[model samples]
Target: MDSRGLIIGMIILLQTTVGILGNFFLLSHYLILYYHECSLKTTDLILKHLTMANTLIILSKGVSHIMTAFGLKEFISEIGCRFSLYVQRVGRSMSIGSTCILSVFQAITISPRSSDWKGLKTKAPKYIGLFLSLCWILYLIVNIIFPIYLLNKKVKSQNMTKAKSFEYCSPGDRDGIMDSLYMALFVFPEVLFSVLILWSNGFMVVILYRHKKQVQHIHSTNVSFRASPESRASCTILILVSFFLTFYTLSSILNACIAFLNSPSWWLVNINNIISMCFPSFGTLVLMNNAPTFSRFCFIWIRNKKSPNFKVAM
Candidate 1:
């Protein structure tokens, strides 16, 4: 393979590896929390789903990417192609929906107790589980065209006269009308989720700014107002969302270029792979670095390690 191909392969390998491990760490943490602590917060529940979806996106997108990067085309059968594409799209849609859900809920969570959404915040989690389930079903059904229109690249090489070919899969021809229909079917949910995220994120920022000013006024009167952990977590979400939007926008641009190009450049395709996986790979680390739960566990682990007789005491 060429130097560029080798470089891309290595980058994809690293990203998928880290993403698999980091997201599983987050997922397993929640499992441990549920079993050990006997319960989970609603926010924790939402984050766990996000982590799972991220893991799904990484796995489905990563395998083909790594193989293609290494020049291992048509590595799977037609069935495999269908499965991968379906899972990848569903996972991506789920991640988008989950992030929007988390942001909107957090905004409500930090809202003033006397606000209009006061009672809704407490009651929201009760129905969120069912809502996410319905959404997953909806996404799966909506993307069913993937399996129907796709065949392994190696399966019908001679017959694909007007189809777009991926590294390992070939999809049926999309005429102008079909293309527009497909765009509407898929892009609608994405646009809707993005709008929700932006609105909720803006609300959270405004709430935070107001809170900061209130704290400043209290300080001036010699009455200290400490920032709550919830506020800190909201700030973290804002930072995380900013990073996500940056990576996602870049990834989307690369995707658009590939779609619009006569024959997509291999370099652009490889760069898109890296950009797509960047957030899922390192987002977990960002969360752990700023998260109170992880820090608390680390502190405990360290303290226990330093105490030679800790086991005996216990």
Candidate 2:
């Protein structure tokens, strides 16, 4: 309706479009790779779950973009709203949980000498399904109230109305309780997991430095390929964490600004939607990058499906 809203809408549209395309490509790659590789290992399973989570987030973002574009509130039906919000929240939590597990698993895999977790690496693959099941159950039980209290359209008191015209589901109903619970349930664990991931990464970095120093002392100029995979994975994790942290900080600042102003501008809403989708979109990007060969294989399969068949000359 205003210049600020228009600008924010355009930016969100651009970001959402890019994120959707990027994630779609990544999802396709990983699915194909999973089938071809057929590992069924813990890492593979965790990655598959992560991809599924990203796909759900992409769907959520697409719907949100459409709603914003049309200036529509409560875009979906009541049931649809409940389902969408449920899936979005569950998917996001799954992504975080799976990532934490991944980091912990990798750290265990690399641990030297006798550590409590090191012995579990041999059995990690067996427990992946159990871990995922637990994650789903925990989040489902906690967020049961989310759908009932937050999603559907309902009447609000005159005190809560902006125009005193009609009733709409107020965004702030679950604000106090949900915010506190979210911090305790999700945010606190995320902080602890991130710290562990960083510490594990630091261990690997120190080892790499020492390894390089030893090689230098011998006047050896050969590049060590042994460190490549671990290094790459560490770098990828760092970038993923960095992106999540940056977006989370930005969202916090935007929220604080809105609170300080005592009113939310249309631009702030658009920006919030955009930033909310950032971590999922970027996680999809990193996963896709890690599976490039699978992307090529899938492309070839698609092209072959559309081509005419030819008979062999005998």
Question: Which is the leading candidate under lDDT?
Answer: 1
Worst 10 residues of 2 by lDDT: 163-172
Runs off by more than 4 Å, candidate 1: 151-166, 170-172, 176-178, 220-226, 298-314
Q: What is the Å distance of residue 200 in model 2 from its true position?
A: 3.9
Give one digit per residue, the lDDT tens place, for model 1 in 1-314: 99988998999999999999999888877886676566778888888888888998899889988888888876887688678888888888888888889899889999989899989988997988888889888888987875765442244546554344354443445467547757788777687888889999999999999888877756755675667899989988887777787888898888778777767766777788789899888888888877888767656556766986664222
Q: Which residue segments of model 2 deviate by more than 4 Å? A: 113-117, 151-157, 162-170, 175-184, 201-204, 211-226, 252-261, 290-314
The residue pairs that clash in candidate 2, if any, are none
**Model 2: per-residue lDDT, tens digit, 1-314?**
66665665576666667777876776565576555565555655776677677667667755656565556766677666567767777777776677777766665665554656666868876887898888888878876667776644354766354431111122444457767877897678767766776676566566557656755655545744344555556556556655665775686677557655545665565566678777766666665576444456777657756774732232
Give the winner by TM-score.
1
